[model samples]
Target: MSVRRPAAEVLQPKSFSFNEKNLLVVDTILSKYPKEKKASALLPLLDLAQRQNANWISTAAMKVISEILSLPLIKVLEVATFYTMFNLKPVGKNLLQVCTTTPCWLRGSDDIVSACKKKLGIDFGETTQDNKFTLLEVECLGACSNAPMVQINDYFYEDLNEDSMIKIIEDIQKGSKPKPGPQSKRTGSEPHNNRVKV
Candidate 1:
């Protein structure tokens, strides 16, 4: 079956450029790849641009990345579109990616999702009106041992119950970064709850 795409995503913005600050970063990422394979840095550059662009990879990001890698626009767009990790649309400041894979689901990920929906008043794939948070149900985040986890931006909040999950969102809205990993003090490396792996 042919996969349908969103009416070509009115994403190609007028133009794009990396600011002076990101120029340094872009150069550094590009430097890690041989000149002949500079395009390999596309993923990292796109990620940096997403962080710089409020978690979405816009037309500007695609264009800028294309220019930097001396690649075709379609090539850059293809990569960006293929990866779910790159949000094509605008997202709130804190992107809450809740893992709903088997492990997390078996461990009450549904309840965590419900709590987020009730607390944030937006369903998965929607952002709160205030733009502080966007909710999403994603695949495994590679932290299954700590199942029922939610990643706010770059940090993982794992071993979550509804209460702890909601509390983490509250802390984020209050401009505080909750400590990452298990909420119950059972870090992921541990063999049991209530203990950190030494």
Candidate 2:
């Protein structure tokens, strides 16, 4: 689904150019596509821009991408605006994408959401004052079997309860990286209690 992302003009940077390392990455990505089809590199280019610009794609960045891909500025803006993954505005260092879909809800995702809100003192779509975390309620993240999960950055911490969720936040606050995956005894998506039937 498309998200409501305002331009938030005040936050926009005056200009954006990929650093030397990322410029090399951009070339590598562009080389995969035919010269005539350089437009195909739009997504990765936008991703690289977002990574370079602190996890959000700015209008300036999109313009640079359009120039690089030989695509129109509007074409790049269309893709960036249409995709929910592209954040138009600034986000925190740790984007906490909590899943509240049916599977996770049935597995007590509400409590997980509550834990995040309480622990961070910020509701969904809000960021902490320290810019450490941004709480967002997202759709399923494909870990239904180990539901009640929250994706912190690129890692998924699943099978969470209120207390466990609180602990995770506390660990992050203390500069410790909480281990990802099932928070319970189960390993991966295996059956609970290790009760494997023949």
Candidate 3:
């Protein structure tokens, strides 16, 4: 069965344009394609623009990208709205994505979600007042054997329990880089107490 993402409420910022550094990145992304095929760079350009403008893609930014690539405004908007990776609304500095698919659920992902709701005082799709963290429950993050895991920003932290999850959240709240991934003594997803291949 095909699944659809619940549409995000898109907000239009009054204006948006990349900074000098990002403009250079934008130029490079565009340069990869022939002038006639520059529109082919739409996905990367939108991604770069979203990162440049903060974590969300504004309508204005989409328009600018459309103009640069000479694609219709609708073309850019269609791509941006269709992909969940392109945040339509603003997200907190730290986006916490918990994996709650079958493997994770069986392995106690509910405990992870409970821990987040308890500590953050917010449910999924909500951000903190301080804009520090946004909590979201996502399907498989591809860490099945590491079963219960979460992705914060770009890092995957695995082998989580309630306390460890809370500690990670608290650490981020205090602006420190908590060590990421496999909080247990185990390395990666290797089974416990194993010194060598089975």
Candidate 4:
């Protein structure tokens, strides 16, 4: 996909001001690496950037982060682009990402997607006119046992049927936190006995 650049006037020199909170996060991540291996902090740094921008990572921001850790631009770019967590473009205030992998699909995520389209009137990768929501179809988020699942903002909503899905969206719209995990009363981390044992 063609990346749309920021307006010419806004494209200025990359300067990163690491605030106390994010600096603490970066420092903690940086501590995990040996002194000489500061470059290993790239993913964590990218995460910090994402958190600051509500899940989006700007190229200029990446460049600035690269400079902070003394890593090459290409190195930072590779890390930024490689991870699905990083968003290159502006995301809506609430990003509604449904897992569309096999397990989720089998659990009726297509119906969830259709519901989202009906409610938001926008398909995946498109933002609502109010800029409040964006719908995206994502790959496995490792909640397959929960089957049909979606992530809003940074929280995951799993084991969804149509009614449950609608309720979750409405809750988010009303500024309430929806309960996470399966609607069927299963907590996360239940061992799947149905799978053939090794």
Best by lDDT: 2
TM-score for all models, in order of appearance: 0.89, 0.93, 0.89, 0.84
Q: Considering lDDT, which of the candidate structures 1 and 3 is the better prediction for this target?
A: 3
Off-target runs (Cα >4 Å) in candidate 3 are 1-11, 195-198
Model 2: per-residue Cα lDDT over 34-138, one tens digit each? 999999999999999998888888888998998898889999989998987888888888989999999999999999998898888888887788888888899
Ranking by lDDT: 2, 3, 1, 4
Local error of candidate 4 at 31, Å? 2.5
lDDT of 1 by residue, 147-189 (tens): 8898888888888999999888889889988899889767564
Q: What total of clashing residue pairs does each candidate reach? A: 0, 0, 0, 0
Please give the range of 10 consecutive residues that has the lowest summed lDDT in model 3.
Answer: 1-10
For model 1, state the Cα shift of residue 67 in Å.
Answer: 1.6
> Candidate 3 on 1-198: residue-level lDDT in tens?
111223454446798888999889988998899988898999999889877876778888988898889989999989998886788778888889999999999989999999998898878888777777888889898988887999998899999999999999999888898898798887888777776765
Give per-residue lDDT, candidate 3, residue 67.
Answer: 86
Model 2 per-residue lDDT at 179: 94
Error at 65, model 1, angstroms: 1.3
Off by over 4 Å in 2: 1-10
